[model samples]
Target: MAVVKVDKKGRLVIPQEIRERLRIDETTPLIFEVDDGNTIRIRIIQRDDQAYTSDPLWKAIHNPVFIGKKVSKKELDEIENDQWSN
Candidate 1:
């Protein structure tokens, strides 16, 4: 196990080896939970756009007044290709 110290701002730097092994990058979404008084659990949240689109609740909310709209494949592709600014 690797030992790490939390900075003053409460951020801990994950070791490079662990990050590489997990294939985690800056954009990866992680979920943290306090399992007990001294233990914490960290999880990676994997998202599938198709799953969200096929959810029954998502379909049920497709009313005229709702602001959410279906994203086209082209738009999604464009977004994926677009470069994000820091």
Candidate 2:
């Protein structure tokens, strides 16, 4: 088990091993919540927007929104290399 100390400024530095395991870094976005006891729980936002750029379904729905119209099925097929129907 790992133990951490909160500094005078109320900041706790997570251990390096834990950070690496959870893929947390300086720029990582997080969501903080509290339980009934008011202890805070922190979660890493793994996807945020990076996945939207490369994830096929997300691209299919969002790509054309940038140009102000729904894309043609043909264009979508081309983007998916004709495998979108499958």
Candidate 3:
């Protein structure tokens, strides 16, 4: 557990220890929402780093709309190896 101070601009630095434990870096995307009137929730959106073919691919693969989806190995391979039509 760590204490973070929110700066004037509503930005706070996540401590190094927590960041390392969460495997969070500059590339990680975060989601924030209000659980109730006084409580807020933050989550580090999980992603498939291993299945990422490139940076763009990583962004596309981890889209929120695709969460809880099960992609078969064959389908993923086909997508990864497929070249852009344009």
Colliding residue pairs in candidate 2: none
RMSD of every prediction: 13.8, 9.9, 12.5
- Kindly list the per-residue Cα lDDT of model 2 for residues 5-86, writing each as its tens digit: 8999998888999999888889786767887685778867666567545778767776664667789988987979866666
Write the residue-wise lDDT of candidate 3 on 3-74 in tens digits.
788999999999998889999999887778999997778877766543334567666775645547899999
Q: Supply every candidate's count of residue pairs whose N, Cα or C atoms clash at under 3 angstroms.
A: 0, 0, 0
Q: TM-score of each candidate?
A: 0.55, 0.49, 0.51
Q: After superposing candidate 2, which stretches have Cα over 4 Å from the reference?
A: 47-86
Scored against the true structure, residue 57 in model 2 reaches a CA lDDT of: 76
Top candidate, metric TM-score: 1
* Regions more than 4 Å wrong, model 1: 49-86
TM-score of 3: 0.51
Is candidate 1 or 3 superior in TM-score?
A: 1
- How many Å off is the CA of 84 in candidate 3? 28
